[model samples]
Target chain A: EAAVTQSPRNKVTVTGGNVTLSCRQTNSHNYMYWYRQDTGHGLRLIHYSYGAGNLQIGDVPDGYKATRTTQEDFFLLLELASPSQTSLYFCASSDWGVFYEQYFGPGTRLTVL
Target chain B: GQQVQQSPASLVLQEGENAELQCNFSSTATRLQWFYQHPGGRLVSLFYNPSGTKHTGRLTSTTVTNERRGSLHISSSQTTDSGTYFCAIGSAQGTGSKLSFGKGAKLTVSP
Candidate 1:
């Protein structure tokens, strides 16, 4: 089975605080994505990386930043956290070949106060 | 903007019953996928049907590319099947890997 894991499964930060959510995948997939899930909104992509050192802006990337330091690791950064950023964040990884079946992490529940 | 819409926002079923979920997209999609999200848990890919029909276990997914729509059928539902089902559409343009997900259809299977 594909393995994707995220760190700080739950976090609480104040407004303007710095927050970083970590994700690592062992499936050797080239594509990694970060998404936020809110009530009635399903899942909204915030950022994605095709490979190490690559980053692509997603549909909702205004208040978030992401980095891909290695093939196995991806990070989502919130430099100035706000209450509105409070949501459940998920990290997923998939390969290019085939249908690009994505495997997701357990997700991080972030609360910005 | 490309949009994916799912019908019957919510569904309730009993054990041994069947369930059908629908998904429609506004634009042409290069890929269509079905995902299951457990309450307070992660999202798991159930099917990656870009076109035609595919089945795994008791789950069957049919995607008609020409119509830009897809359907997922669950046979003999179980309580463990209760969760949110999401359909995502991917375009050929740009990265071709980015997916636009629908609001999802929440399913509740009772014993």
Candidate 2:
């Protein structure tokens, strides 16, 4: 089984504070993604990386940045957290071949005040 | 924006019964997947049927590429089956990697 792990399952930050959510995958997948889940809406992709040192913009890339330091670690960075950024963040990874069934991390809930 | 609409935002089922969830895509897709999210906040992979029909345990997923739709069927529902089921579709973008997810169907199975 593949495993994608996320850190700081829960976080509380003040407005204008910088926040970073980390994700690590043991599956050695080539693709990693960051998404935010809000109430009444489906998951919105924030950013994704095809490999180390590579990042691509997603549908909802504003107010967020991501870094894929290695195949095992992908980090989501919020330069200046705002109340609007408060949402449940999920990190997922998958092979380029089987993109449909991407393995997801447990998710990190960030609360921006 | 690509949209994947899922029917019946919520559902209630009794044990030993059956349930079905539908997903309709605005456009064609070559990849489809179904995921189960337990109340504890962990997502478990269910199926990755890009096209045609596939079954696992008491769950069956059928994706019709021509019709641009997908359906997930759960048979003999159990308490453990209570959770949100999400249907995701991958378009031609990025050579397959990013997926658009549905609003999900919240299912509650009772004894």
Candidate 3:
């Protein structure tokens, strides 16, 4: 099993607050992704990166920005967060992109008041 | 965008019973995977089946690529099997691929 860890397992902030969720994968996978899970929306992709300094827009990329500074690190930034953005955020990594199996982190629960 | 639909939406089963979950996709998918999320918010990949049948422990996954459909079967369900199961379909896009997930089938196995 690949090792994927996430920091700040839980977060709470007021409207228009800044929040950053961090993910690190020690498996050296080339692809990393950020997704949000909501009640009726299931899990929607926010952003993804194939390697360092490379980013790709996903199905749901609005209101979110992502940076892959290094192959092992990927970050999701929620600037001026809104109450609708409150959801469980997950980060995942895969060796062969979305065609292969992905290892997921424990997930970060974010609440925007 | 590819659309994935899961059947039943939710299921309730007793311990020792068998469970079946279905997934259907609107477009052709080159790969399919099943994931299980624990109540504690941890997600685990259960199977990466593109076609045919694969089994691990009491869980089995069967996928038909041509039909764009997949099925997961759980034998002798246990209380620990209670969680949300997601089915994702992968489609090729240029040099890479993209995955689309269904709303998921919430299963509750009671003692």
Off by over 4 Å in 1: A97-99
TM-score of 3: 0.97
What is the Cα-based TM-score of model 2?
Answer: 0.95
Clashing pairs in 2: none
* TM values, all candidates: 0.95, 0.95, 0.97
Candidate 3 regions off by >4 Å?
none
Candidate 2 lDDT by residue in tens digits, B22-82: 9999887768989898887677879988888999999999999899899999999999999
Choose the strongest candidate by DockQ. Answer: 3
Task: State which candidate has the highest TM-score.
Answer: 3
Give the candidates in order of lDDT, highest first. Answer: 3, 1, 2
At residue A67, give the lDDT of candidate 1.
Answer: 96
Total backbone collisions for each predicted model: 0, 0, 0
Scored by lDDT, the top model is 3
Task: Summarize candidate 2's per-residue lDDT along A1-113 as a digit string, tens digits.
Answer: 88999999999999999999999999878989998988777788899988999898889998888999998999999999999999999999888733435889999999999
Least accurate stretch of 10 residues (summed lDDT) in model 3 chain A? Answer: A95-104
Error of 3 at B4 (Å): 0.5
Model 2, which residues run further than 4 Å from truth?
A97-100, B94-96
